[model samples]
Target: MALLAQQLRTPLSTINALAQGLIRRADRLSTHDVQVKAEKIWRASLRLDELIETILSYTRASAGGIMLNPGEFHLSELIKRVCREQGGQEPDRPFHLDVKDVPETIVGDPILLEQALVIVVSNAMKYSRPDQPIDVTARGEDGMVRITIKDRGIGIPERDLPFVLQPFFRGRNAKKLPGTGLGLSLAWYILKLHGGNLEVESREKRGTKVTLMVPETNTTGLSYSI
Candidate 1:
């Protein structure tokens, strides 16, 4: 978790500047710069929010105190929202969202699901080359909803695949990365709570593909209204 906190270092600096301005001269912030700075503050705060969400996922899962507020929503829309949130983080990069035969609405804890998807998507981006494209796609079949996050980046070794879901366990290839390896673990815990599963496939020199599988809602199996 301390390693994850490192991601917020840059944002925290901007936040400090904003706070100092507001503290010393609230009146002189003016309308234009105030709005711009406010937006900066908002973005920085969101980074903190992501950190809190990721940490709570681990703490909540470990305590067996995980909970959900189930609701109905379009899965593709939720995917789009997660991509959009992350898109801001890497404004220069693009994520190809290929959704097909997706249900219009499904029942589940959207917040938790979104967090899980964000983890998968962010990892796909982080582990891959910035110049490469990350793919996000979804489809419903049989009794399940399957979402795939594919990246054409450095792949995980077969030996490491078995341990990737273990808390704080990063593959040899991932050791150079900054994460403490909590993302996949938290994602697995969330999916397990929802009767879902997270799976991965990769090669050393090739790329990797992660699939998130969950059972379809009783009322909407493989059927989409829009």
Candidate 2:
């Protein structure tokens, strides 16, 4: 929760500063400048919402209260949306998505699936250099859909790889970075709830790749109410 408070501070500050700036300088600013500032504020608000939702979901997941409302949805569209949104937040960075081999549709809870993808992609952006590209690729294999996110950033120490998905467990090299370390843990739980799994591979200072696999059909009947 302390890290959650820390993460919230950034977007909250952006929203407050931009709002106050617009209030004081709207009369002197150009219309285009005002529009740009408003967009930044909107994006910051969205970031704040995502951070809070992630924390709440993590809490619910830890309590075994999360559920899956599985249904059919376009997997490609979902991936595209995550890349687009994440790229928008960090315009300097690039998110390259490749889904030609993936099925057009898959059966699962789209909302939760999207959240998992968002978390992974956001992590890629956070650790990677702004100039580096984040690659997201999706494909179908052996009755499951595989989505992988790759980044050229500060990779995890081999010893830390096993605990990367554990809540509040940040890599020694990543300890100084700004993150709560709950995103991957929450994302892994979401995938498991949908009869899926998460995988990670990394090398210190090289790069990292995380893969998420979910069955093409919701046969597990995993559902809960909270």
Candidate 3:
């Protein structure tokens, strides 16, 4: 509630102030100046939209509303598609999709897993530099499929690591970033629903590595879905 209240205040104040500015400077202001204020108002509205979406996801996760439908699909194709989706969100940024040792197929709730993967990728984009490649690597190990996303971004502080999975628990370095601090929490909930775990390793200013591990579907030695 506090975060929401704060988010409401910051953007609402900006829009109100900007509107007042336009009203006061109606005759004096140039078109370019009005354009700049409009841009800020638009940006704030987008931020509000993001905050509301985060709250909705968090509410759903808390209400135990998420369910999974596991089926077989090509992990490579899904990974590529997810990377493409996130990549499109930031056209100027580059992503490196490295699929090594990954199984050709896996059983999962494609929709939920796609959401989880995109959250991971989007976080990488938000923190890391445009020039720094977001490296996504997948592999199979010990009856589980593991995906690791490495970001050369402003890494999380050691003290913040334990609380990253908690909703609205922003890291020390992440305070400046525009987020509701629910991305990892939502991803964590979705992975748990799919019998998977999300893990992270990082050093302050060094970088962060997030690994999502899900046990391979055990169909009594049946390798392919019928």
List, residue by residue over 1-226, the lDDT tens digit for candidate 2.
6777888998899999999999999889999999999899988888788788978897898787777787899999999988997898778887777899988788889999999998999889889888999999998999999999999999999989989988888999998776788889888888888878899999998899999998998845454322
What TM-score does each of the candidates earn?
0.77, 0.87, 0.77
Candidate 2 deviant stretches above 4 angstroms: 32-36, 221-226
> Cα lDDT of all candidates, in order?
0.79, 0.87, 0.79
Which pairs clash in the backbone of model 3?
none
Worst 10 residues of 2 by lDDT: 217-226
Best by lDDT: 2
Q: Which portions of model 3 miss their true places by more than 4 Å?
A: 5-50, 218-226
lDDT of 1 by residue, 3-114 (tens): 6667556568879988788778777778887787788898788767766777766777777666766777788899988888887777777788887677778787788789
Per-residue lDDT over 16-103 for candidate 3, one digit per residue giving the tens place of the 0 to 100 score: 8989998999899899998988888876775576567667777877876656667888887888898987787567787888886888
How far off is residue 3 in model 2, in Å? 2.2
- Candidate 3 local accuracy as lDDT? 0.79
